[model samples]
Target: MSGHQMPATESVWDYPRPPALLRETRRITVECGGDVVADTTKALKILETSHPPVFYVPPDDVRTDLLRAAPRRSWCEWKGSAEYWDVVVGTDIRPLAAWSYPAPRPPYELLIGHVAFYAGRVDRCTVGGCTVLPQEGDFYGGWITPEVKGPFKGGGHTHGW
Candidate 1:
C-alpha cells in the first residue's frame, strides 16, 4: 500500500480512530548504546490507521533509571496529553526517545504508565526477533516490523493525505 512493500497483511487503513490495544506476548526488546534498555514479553500494541503498531511496555520491565522525563508535552485527542522521556545510556542520550499517556482516556486507561519508544531513535527495537523500522515521521512512534505492511501516515507526501 502507498509506496511501501505490500505483503498479505493487515492494512493500516482498517484500523480504528480511537485505536485498539492488543496484548503482545512476543519478545519486545529496545536497545541503546549497546545496552538493553527495555525487554519484555508483556507489551501492549496500539494500532491506528495508517500507522504500524506502537508497542508499550510496562514500567516494571523497563530500566527506569535510564529514562528521564523531558519538559515537553503534547496532546492526543484520543489518548490524552503525552509526556516525553529521554533514554540515557552512559554517554548516549536519546532526547525524547519515548512517551506515555499519563492519564489516558477511559478506553486507553491501560496505557496510563506504559512507555513506547521511538524505534528509529533507539539503537535497536525488535519484535518477535525481527528488527523494526521506525515509522517515517518524527511525530508518530510506530514500529514497522517485517510482518506488518503499511502505507503509514508520516514523513513525505502524506501531509495532506
Candidate 2:
C-alpha cells in the first residue's frame, strides 16, 4: 500500500474513508443481452479505500423500462439503503444486476436515484470504449479500467481491509 511502490498509480489505500465522488466525462456504456442498457459520458465515480471506482450513471441515460425492481435491499453506513434492480433485455434476465440509493444520506445526496451496474453481472461494461474488469470479489461492484491501478482490496485476503 506504499505510494512509493508505483509512481504512476493511485493506491487504493490512499483513498479516503467514507468514500469520495469524482465526476468523469469518459464514455460509459453498459450492455446486456445485446441491448444497450446504459450509455452516457456524464458519470460519477465513487472512490474509497481498498476498492476500485464504482460509476453511477444518471437515470436519464439508462433504459428504465428494461429494469424491474428487485426484492433485495442492502444498507451502507455512508450512502444509506440501496434497492436492487433486475435487468431484462430480449429474453435475458439478470437479477440484482444494478442498484441505486433512492434516498441517500448526507454527503451522498448526489447519488440519489442514480444507478450503478455490476460489471460482473452485465454482459459488458465499458469506459471510454475500453471494456472494464469487474472487481475481484463477488460482492463489490467496482469497475477496473486501465487508468486505475490496484492491489485492490475486493479479492482474497481483503476481509480485514
Candidate 3:
C-alpha cells in the first residue's frame, strides 16, 4: 500500500472519501451478466498499493447497460475526471476497456462517478478464486475482484496499453 503520493501541485482530498475495503467486504462481486453489476455493500477503497485495489462504486450501483461510452480520454492529476469503457460482453467486443472518475478532485470527490476496470479488457478476470494473468501493456487488466489474487497488469496480445 503506497501509491497516492501526489504533490506536484498538491491536491488529494477536500471531501468525498470513503473506500478501503478489507473487512471481508461482502466477499466482493462485479458481475455483468446476471446483473449485480458491482456490489460491496458500501464504499470500498484500497488506494495504497503497487497496483491491485480500486473498488470505488456508487454510480447508481453500475449496470450502466453493460457500459458503452468510450470516446477515449485519460487524465489523473490525482484522481479527477476521466471516462472510458466499452465492455459489452453479451456479444463480445471489449472496446475502451473501462475507466471512471465522473468528476473527482475533492480529495477524489468519492470518485465522482466511480468506475474502474482494466483487468485486461474484462471478459473473465476473477480473483481469490484465481484467474488473472494478463497485465503487461495492452490496456490494463489489473485489480479484478474476488479477493485480489492472480496476474493482471495490462493484458496480452499487443495493442496500445
- The local distance difference test score of each candidate is 0.91, 0.90, 0.54
Clash count for each candidate, listed in order shown: 0, 0, 18
Candidate 1 segments whose C-alpha is farther than 4 A from its true place? 1-8
lDDT agreement of model 2 with the native: 0.90
User: lDDT tens digits, residues 97-128, model 3?
Assistant: 66887776656565666676665555443433
Error of 3 at 37 (Å): 2.6
Top-down lDDT ranking: 1, 2, 3
Give the poorly placed runs of model 2, Cα more than 4 Å off.
Answer: 1-8
lDDT (Cα, tens digit) per residue for candidate 1, span 1-161: 47855445687889887799899999999999989999999999999988899999999989989999999899988898999999999889999999999899878899977999999889999998889999998999999886677788998888986
In candidate 3, which residue ranges exceed 4 Å CA deviation?
1-32, 44-69, 74-79, 92-99, 109-113, 116-161
User: Which scores higher on lDDT, 2 or 3?
Assistant: 2
Model number with the top TM-score: 1
In terms of lDDT, the poorest run of 10 residues in model 1 is: 1-10
TM-score of each: 0.93, 0.91, 0.27
Model 1 earns a TM-score of 0.93
Candidate achieving higher TM-score, 1 or 3: 1
